[model samples]
Target chain A: MTTRTPFDIPAHASSDDPRVTLDEALGTFEPIPPYPPRTEREAEFYTLRDGEMFVNMGPQHPSTHGVLRIVLKIDGENVVDLDPVLGYLHRGVEKLCENADYHQAICYTDPLEYISSLFCEWSPVIAFEKLLDVQVPRRAEYIRVLSGELNRIASHALFMGWFALDLGGLTPILWSFIERDEIVEMLAALTGQRMLFNYFRIGGVNGDLNHEFMSRLGTWMSKATHQIDSNNALLNENEIFVRRARGLGVIDTATALNMCMTGPNLRATGVPFDVRRAHPYSIYPELDFDIPSRTEGDCLARYLLRMDEIKQSLRIIDQCLHEMPDGPVMAKMPRLIRPRPGRAYAAVEGPRGQYSTYAISDGTDQPYRMRIHDPSFVHLQAVGLLTPGNLIADTMAIMASLDPVMGGVDK
Target chain B: MDRALRRRLEARFGEELTGPVRQRHDETEIRIAPGDLPEVMLALHDEPDLRFRLLSDLAGVDTGTTMQTVYHLWSDSSADWLRVIADGLSRDDPRVPSVTFLWKGAEWMEREAYDMFGITFEGNRDLRRIYMPPDYTSFPLRKDFFLPDDASRSPGGGVRPMEQTHGPTNAETAAHVRQASSS
Candidate 1:
């Protein structure tokens, strides 16, 4: 064994060649031969047929959205099989939450899905509240619904851009970003951050809606639907975009349910099984909104389903604003919360489907075990099932349509 | 809580359950022995009146004494989220049946549970580490993993475990060196 000190400057520290150690670490990246297969699964995945070959795509590729690497076994251009290699971004968020106090634990989950951090924060906050059995004030619940809907619109806006960009269109991303930026700025005015907004607190939100947020929301709500529709017209009817996406990666409803797929991806397959409508939680039963669904179950269907859902979110936000309640935002709770020894499971309808948290408290300040079930992790697993019969080019299209953020996948 | 759903679960599997069916808030849970996992899961999936088609979440928990594999199921037949816990598995050799035959997507969640808590799913074909390095020996999420202690004795630390074992300096000195580095 070799010995080293923490402060030691290695032999290559001053060397201009950065690629020297990296080259040694990369070591061909071949499936099997130098490194023997450790499990039956590895052996099966690595055993390529005579006409088939493996193509390694992005732990760094642009279309991957985050640092997700997928190894594809291809026969010419058609993909025979694909295996997703995760953990490039794993930070052990569950373990971290176990170590942290209940209130502080919300910070760890904030970055799990960077694009939809509000939903990420909402699940755990609600779970912790359930464990403590605190009833949040009605106004706070309304604020959560309002801001969460705004965040969902922002998340879907980014999704529209990324989906079109993956299909080789550049202008749609620019248009979508402008729309996304407006909502993001409004959220920043409401909460204090743009990206990983740790705004959701246990039993309520961090603060009530401010004047700037309301003014911005009022301005944006008037023309938001028209802007999104005008931006979508660039690719919604285009022959190339529609043809490329329409029939690609079609997953039937039964298969989707069997795979435990949730959110818009499953809705695209014609089952309107949304957590909000099915299992009503946190002011959703009071809100008047429809769970938009599509029957095609293709990449195009998934893309269009999200577009329909965004209009529904705007409607929900409008209703929340009109029916704003008069009460304090926060519930009565201890500063150092010690929930009773029990378990609680809370799920919210996120932009990516059911973002849920299962917490087991040992009647202590810290959770005994906090199990976070990210939909991206579950949705990404079905990629191997969906991409087998399609071409290698269509793999990225299917993945983009499914929209698995790597942060959530690797958490 | 849905009292009818709880009654349906109790009537269906009263003999198989290890404990009373627990209902709290919007959740209902049942605990069963590890041996009864496959049959119970099959009945939950196949029976028309109790068709819990959607497997919402699967997680493994190490409660310092024994291991548990928990399954959260969502179905239209029930109004509450049904949580089925396969409890009382020996921590040294925790083994449970794979639910992949029912929900193929559970293959990954089972892999993740195995990766974190070292619980083995007997019939899972792809039972490899989902998050950790392939050669990693210790499970990170196990109760006895002791992360902070292991982090102090990491390879790059000035006071190596080897030095504490054989060198003239005592274990306290090694701990001191770790603190010095952390500072």
Candidate 2:
């Protein structure tokens, strides 16, 4: 039994080194004061009518995704106002990245959007690469497109499952997980880890798609269409599902743009703006794909748009496989990757929305600033704005429709 | 295209331009004094030619010498991405006017700016901390306010978990969660 006390310092540990011991360093930082006493009442954000009351929804509810607490001020089943209290999942990721090396930070991004972590990791990788001006080979671009589209399918598939599950169904999620697990397994074959595959490197992807990966992808592509068709046949045609989803929580273009919602949620509002087409990052310009959008701007519209995206993603993957060029995946780089002191904003079309990263390097191996434009974080705010007038039960459907993963929201 | 933007912005907000309109390889941004932010942003939003309607992203950075708040704007019609840097905010008392009135997107972003950099947006109505607990005094994003035994140290890795130096998260919980699953 070898249990070591933290106080047992090594003999070689120097008293001279400030980092070695606590020694007055603990006093430097001000401690966070505890929240207020139970008796003291804070001013209500919403003035409730005489009979109205406030309902506290989960900080740990299944429906809110992950530890998302929403306080709804309701007046007879109709929500008068709602406030989203965030920060349950915050780990000071930005602060940690500021201290870690540019390349070392890629590992930290995996947990940020665990569902579609590849897309989450893509923004920072491309942003850091842009600042360094590293030239990714054409082959690497094709691989990225292939893997990214597959990952997108996996993400939206998971969404398809959960979106239905949240609306009181289990079978859709069962169908979703089957396809999702297969995709994850194939991804593991390509990238080593299942979820949060830190596969993207400073220059390019960590590795190339093997023959096994290619053949597996070929098999999965055909199967994916069947799965999509099955899911569409199962859910979209269901009158009950359609009634639950359609014409509920519609956001107009002006309001959607103002609130800064992105991806399918924004596209649902009739804006034909996809960052892939709009920004022209990677080899998306060369790839033949259409930006699928919906004019309805409701829960069903958003749902259908995501379904449409899966078909488009498959199209992109097919093109990448057919038009793939042969070359090295990684770009040549200096031993220590220290980009020059400058700023760059690079964006990728995340499964949910615009997963943008803003990188500022200060001539050090570490980045000065790495700010993420998390789509879920922005989308969560819509809960406050849009949820006010809707029915209390509809909040889940509306939130589910937005496709929020707390990894992105609370990062 | 950037040359024309430089000319147009230069002709409009001449003296307000803190540095030369820096049009980098990937990003295009015009640096302006913090006081000139409202005027420039309003002009950028309302202008027919330069219709930067969407406030895509806003972030604050502490660059050793000074703190800067950067805004990324996307114009729908023209398909142009623009970066606007509002620099020279006091590290001690960083403040900028809230753009919430202009664009509702700035509401949460401005709160985030306040939470991370202590950069108060003057006109923002709901300027409470978004990520961190309301009581947390120190701004986590600043270069100086570090977690205990940060990994940058050359000596060794941190033996103990982190203390409550940053935001709502403390190291005790982190340590407990990281322990072996079997036990």
Candidate 3:
């Protein structure tokens, strides 16, 4: 396969055009009012005069999930200011998409949101199919749903594992992975890749599920559910876990709605705002499930909501397997997919939140411009809001509850 | 609520929702003049039927000659989405008004557009680089931007030599080896 080198601009380009350069522009750009100075003495001399310790929380910390650094200003325990420094994992996915073809681009999307790779694949593929108005067969939709649900389970499993690890429980992480490995194996059998599965094509999936794969998947699903139930029972009943999680980083429904938070985080705030139920896509309307929500709007509520959602996902997967029709997995698609000049935005309920792909195609095989609206990007905003009044010790727990996958956030 | 709100939005926004407006696949686009974006967006949020409270995403597309800023706005109350496009920003001055004042989520979205597309948000609080390094040079997303080839630069210019071992295998080397006489 042919591969092009990543684009790199000359260092002197900024010197030639200072307006386009961030450093040059920021040199003269005034800092926001009520700013603190760089050094301790300088900061003390400033208006807010309270002695606050400045600590950088990442660029290396384990809770970040990837390369993410947050420069935080703390007054004793409460955070006064937070500046998230990104780009440590910025592989220039957008720039790469520009050069890659529509089919080739799907490979890149999976890696962007590594945790919910299926949702990432689903959003772009569905967007491409919509742009082209390709009619995917019934079987394809069922397969898509099956894979999507399995992906959701895997994603939530990872979240539960990491969340338990964050809470200083190691055994749950290992147990959660026991199910994750089965799901990954199923995905690999279908898609040929484990982590970054570029299985979804424009019109339909890359291929059909074999009978042997289906039986194996069915066997794994039963065991996974029992494991999920036992794990939830273990974590939920612990008094220390409840004390640390319940009522910590409490956010009301109003704030969540105002901020446009989606997925489990918004549901935890007592708003049944799941994209699957509200704006049904990929035969989700035909499925049997309820949007799990909690009225407490706290860390524990969010955790419980995710646990319950996993059960709902399992229900969807079972329904998909039972009712899955036999037909063509891939719809009839043109060799070159050239859509009419227009734009479309297709969003799916990703593990983190609402993952949307907005594609603008000027009647070409490749999109004119594709913009991805990752939920983690918006969820990161909630971090600054929730951490301000909480203790430094609670920062990791609050962040873990949010489950901000740096891949999605940075991409 | 769904059908009535869309109609009310179309009526209130008048010509703003008319001609040159197109729908493809799942995305809907309503083209508006650059000067009219603020008024159109304000009406979209204010209208009872189309309470698009959240500005989900804002991005700039460089179409060679001109730039088009696309806004993806969603309503949590209604579960509907509206994509508004404002086209025709001059290459020299790619400035657009900040929507962060309306939706708090637009704070970083605008910063990202500014960083990648060099689209200036007139009143954005943080306009620094969001994805690229602080000292990054050109806007890499533009069509004219090209990745420099290591071998093209002069050796004494402090330009690092191309690491021949990395990246895609060179086709020219294979061609040269094939052309060589049998030894």
DockQ leader: 1
Off by over 4 Å in 3: A1-48, B1-6, B15-20, B24-27, B76-80, B148-183
lDDT of 1 by residue, A1-411 (tens): 334343454655755644223333333566443566767888988998899998889778999998988899999899999889889999999988887889889999999999999999998898998989899999999999999999999999999999999989898899999999999999999889998899989988889889999899899999998998897788788999999999999999999988899999999989899999999888999989999999999999999999999999988998998999989988877789998888999888899989999999887688889999999998998889889978888889999999999999999
Better of 1 and 2 by DockQ: 1
- Chain A TM-score, cand. 1: 0.93
Report the error of model 3 at residue B3, Å: 6.9
- Residues B1-183 of candidate 3 have per-residue lDDT tens digits of 245445555667677653444443334457787777778878777777677766667778877666668888776555456678787776556777777666666777877887777787776666767887665556766554533442232244343322222111111122111111110
Pairs that collide, model 3:
A130-B25, A344-B27
What DockQ, on C-alphas, does every prediction get? 0.37, 0.24, 0.20
Tens digits of per-residue lDDT, candidate 1, B42-102, equal 9999999998999999999877667799999998988899999999887667899999999
Candidate 1 residue pairs in clash (backbone atoms < 3 Å): A263-A353
Please state the Cα-based DockQ of model 1 relative to the true two-chain complex.
0.37
Candidate 1 docking: what grade?
acceptable
DockQ of 2: 0.24
Across all models, the iRMS values in order are 7.6, 10.3, 11.8
What candidate 2 gets wrong by more than 4 Å, as runs, is: A1-47, B76-80, B151-183
lDDT of 3: 0.75
Q: Of the candidates shown, which would achieve the greatest TM-score relative to the real structure?
A: 1
- Model 1 residue runs over 4 Å out of place are A1-28, B149-183
